[model samples]
Target: MNILKSFFCAGLMSSTMAATSMVSGSAIAAEVKLRLLETTDIHVHLADYDYYRDKQSDKVGLAKVSSLLKTARSEAKNSMLFDNGDLIQGNPLGDYIAKEKGLKDGEVHPVYKAMNMLNYDAANIGNHEFNYGLDFLKKSIKGANFPYVLSNVYVLDGDKDPSNDKPLYDPYIIINKDVIAEDGSKHMVKVGVIGFTPPQIMQWDKANLEGKLRVEDIIDSANKYVPQMKEKGADIIVAIPHSSVSTSERKGMEENASAYLSKVEGIDAILFGHGHLVFPSKKYEGFPGADVAKGTLNGVPATMPGFWGSHLGVIDLTLSGETGNWKVSDGTGSVRGIYKRDGRKTIPLVEADAAINEAIKHEHEETIAYMRKGVGKTTAPINSYFALVADDPSIQIVTNAQKWYVQKLVNGSEYDGLPVLSAGAPFKAGGRGGPDYFTVVPAGEIALKNVADLYIYPNTLRVVKMTGSEVREWLEMSAGQFNQIKPGMDGEQALINTDFPSYNFDVIDGVTYKIDVSKPARYSKKGEKVSDGHRIVDMMFDGKPVDPKQEFVIATNNYRASGGGNFPGLKGDNIIISAPDENRTILANYIFDQKTINPSADKNWSFAPLSGKAKVSFTSSPSAKDVATSMGFETMGMAENGFAKYRIDLSK
Candidate 1:
């Protein structure tokens, strides 16, 4: 039996209510059950195996999710499958396909291969799809039989934002699927599927998108196309937006705008992503019109399938229609988890689907071989266990590469001779990825797999001009990683704020500062001024107090430079150079050029000295036990969940 649970709030109608809504006899319109299945942020996991670890992992893979798809489809009479973007690039396999295997003019990427074999009805373009440039994206999707809808982006008429004059892709697809009613009679159901991706793609992918395209705001595009879908005789409209409901404001051109998108007049349901979070979760509590218990926003049913094929987003709509038209009577949303993550262990629900594994068999084999090749050697062990506690090498190498690349890229340009800074973050630190997820590359010859472990995302390098004050705000946002604590009253206060993602804890190189955790955060992750105290103190550049007006070039990934984490004063307009190189490739080149890369992290930032004795605790991999003290932390022995708890004596 499917472990299906309803996320309906009290007084909200459910499947039980749908059964009671039908009229008594022939006076009843036809009641059709439509199952809309969505897979999002798959990130090129076509199989159940981790190409880097060379082991089977239950936590990912579309093949394992394919089993869930078949089961989900079997439970309903009429079903439609969709991919909510971010499918083309993410893992070592995706990197291998892009760097080694290479895409020919008409060849299909393995991601599209698996997506096509799964019979995706329609898919949207994800921001990462633009990582390899437009030609690559255009060529990669050639093998897909289904249409890829992108409502917001447009072909530029003369170098401006998306206009009504031209759309880059098909705005929507009206699928004329034959529906079978409870009476065993079949009728045509005009189901409209419209897709919206982040309009910030124009900024995040400025290198590839500048002169070629302009992406309109998602809410604006939805307001325009949703009505068109209705006028085109669509019975039901399902929006597959590669965006999420992440911000506090329910309106704006915010990266995650699914909540407002759902409020549009004609949209019946929405699938949101790119934040890699599970919706209908407790994280969305207190938002007006957002019923976490009901998996809805503004009364429109929605769901976000977890990333890496972890779960399948399912929305069931009970439609009762007249001979020529249909209206949604009852609707509900739920997600099916293919694996159960318990601490360090994962339990798979089903085996990998045979057809999907067979579909990308060759690419998988090649990717494995590519990841194992030695890139260069490291002078010392590189691990991220101490990332939050101290400056870490895993982040240092990436920043060093960015700084190196950007310094050279801006050498002869109009912004020459300006001091360069780089923002670095621990990507593989133990957070949502679990304790064992921290990067641990032993001192030796580093392989492509280790490089992937060091830098996980496929973000490209960028250089943005930032004022000293804006730079302080950037560090202030990164300093939000800590939990506020009084000097003498703490007992086992968590060192890191669990809610703040490790990815956004950026350490700004080429400067020095102190984070005073006793003070409330200057700004929350949502850019809200929840408190007024500034945690970033003694922020300096070049041995002098940072001048608020002084301009400095900071090398950063496209995500941060394009206001990805919502950092202040950072956006496309400030960008001076948008390199077409991925950070991983830049790191590989830097290592290869140096031959013996030293894993050294500059102690640029540290916690402020407290007035009295205070203590805090954090969890790290058990492997960090032997080296905990040398890193200035006292191990409190292993916890029951297999993590090593360490205590920080702030008095030191």
Candidate 2:
């Protein structure tokens, strides 16, 4: 007989309702309820404020989620709170603490000050946790009141096998807790918790972890240690993989491996994230081995809350049987949002936790003042509203800054005299972040916050050398951001593929090309060749066609140069220059040196004309009308979810 008990499947319900029904009026059946609460991918939005826009926001903040945490804990007699990582870095507050304020020997990070107040049981190591280097990460986490658990990261001792290596943190922790049973008797339940991070951290943060640390595969690490946790008197095991749930087949080292991790034996429940998406919602209704209604992946209950403290993931497990033979008989998983959206209005579901706000008050104010200091000036407004549709000034400025910085570094080196191109993407273009997420820097003094807004990530500058043929292949991979449209297709076709992340759509400067949306995409989002389509046409450099064998240097971020998005041909080996300065700081320096700058797109790229009068449409912020009309786009009135629809005639 299998020791793992089969879960009772049921429709989704509120955490309170599930807790009330499970524990109310029960016989002496030795039944117990264990409520697990999770917060993942917070990205350090400690307060209800948008640092990019420098204003109060109703959409994100941990201060607001704290109230929801209180209510969820109140509904259950036995509860444990766990953070799924990505807590130390995201917003300007995180940057302020990591780059400006600096963590002293015993000084606690502001985010930790707030998290310690909430009393997190344990936290998994997220990929972004290594963004500020290993030293900063170590000092920051030292202030946490709770222990951090990770099974994959290791420090090898002259062994090739990870099993022989020493772990950076404890692989798992078995917590012994006393809880009231359905029979009104006290029972000690030993709950085991284990964690796994994306193994690709080695590549993403190569500068930080290359020689010091090694990461094992997520599934392999789980298979290695889960049985040990079971043998050590753990009645139940909960897995917290800082990874997303994917329906893709497992081939090892996948960034999203929760679906594969769920198949590991002894994993009674799972809390997964890193995709910044919500599970148990309609978005994941049809994924393989997923029961959205029951909130289970392969019959194991799981939950992934939205990022930036927007939702609280709740997993309630009801175990029944004798003391030593207790098993999970029933469970339900769901996410509770801090706010709700009704058209353009935001309805707050919970108030900000006063205690959390008070804990981080000093740091929050300092971050604001630090972000407000002016760096330079911009003669024209820079916005990412039309970054995907056309060559916009927002991306143009970043590319220009990158090219300027790289040119100085590689001036007389072995890579000198090569044609330098730059790649930039819109990080703030709204999708899941809502309409207010786009960057809008008005024509005036450019502050440090505005520079941070343009480049949201803390990616360092890198230059990769590739042949012209390989560069085209790089652009081909970015072309996956668009959906294929048939000529003379009925109705308006969607122009952009919303499923494709805006960050992956790289716009290469110093080259001109046209994207033929009528043709099939040559590459998929995963860099797999699914079609033989050549969507890039009329590619030119210096008023002539680019030679296939010609060599060129491309300035980009470390993430892309190190195969962060799985782009073709370019990897860590080809990178010639890995500058220590961050791209945001370079941009700030470029702007400061210029004193006053003008940002205007060179119109290096556009959509190829269709044979017939085909029309395509995409949604953007309602405030983007002036920019759209100035570019001669036809407005299609208001769209759903407070977006303004615009149509483009491809036949033009």
**Each model's number of backbone clashes?**
1, 0
Model 1, runs deviating above 4 Å? 1-28, 159-164, 282-287, 292-294, 404-420, 464-470, 490-492, 526-533, 540-553, 572-580, 627-629, 634-646
Instruction: Give per-residue CA lDDT, model 1, range 1-652, as digits (tens).
Output: 2333234442345444434433322334678888889899988988998766668787789998999999999999989898899988888888777777788877888887787777888888888899777888888888789898988888877744334348778989899887767654466678898888887787667667878887778888889888899888998899989997754665667788887888799889898888787776776788767888778878888889888898899988888975358888877777888877565566778888989999899989888887888888998998998898788888899888888888888888888988899988998877666566788889989988888888888788888888898999888888788888778884678878888888889998999898888888888886666776789999888888999999899988888887777787876778888788888889988888888889888888888888887788888887888678787788897664457789887754
C-alpha lDDT of candidate 2 relative to the true structure: 0.90
lDDT of 2 by residue, 1-652 (tens): 2333322222223344445534553233578999999999999998988998898877799999999999999999899999999999999999988988899999999989999999898889999999999899999999999988999999866657656778988989988867777545666788899998999999899888888889989999999899999898888999999999776778888889999998998899999999999988998888998899989999999999999999999999999864556689988889999998788778999999888889999999999999999999999999999899899899999999999999998899998899999999999888888877798999999999999999999999999999989989999999999999998778879999998899999999999999999999999898899898799999999999999999999999999999888899867999998899999999999999999999999999999999986889998898999999999888888887678899888885
Off by over 4 Å in 2: 1-29, 158-163
576 Cα displacement, candidate 2 (Å) = 0.8
Q: Which pairs clash inside model 2?
A: none
lDDT of each: 0.82, 0.90
RMSD of 1: 7.1
Estimate the TM-score for candidate 2. Answer: 0.95
Question: Considering every candidate listed, which one attains the maximal TM-score?
Answer: 2
| lDDT for residue 29 in candidate 2, whole number 0-100 | 51
Model 1 TM-score relative to the real fold: 0.88
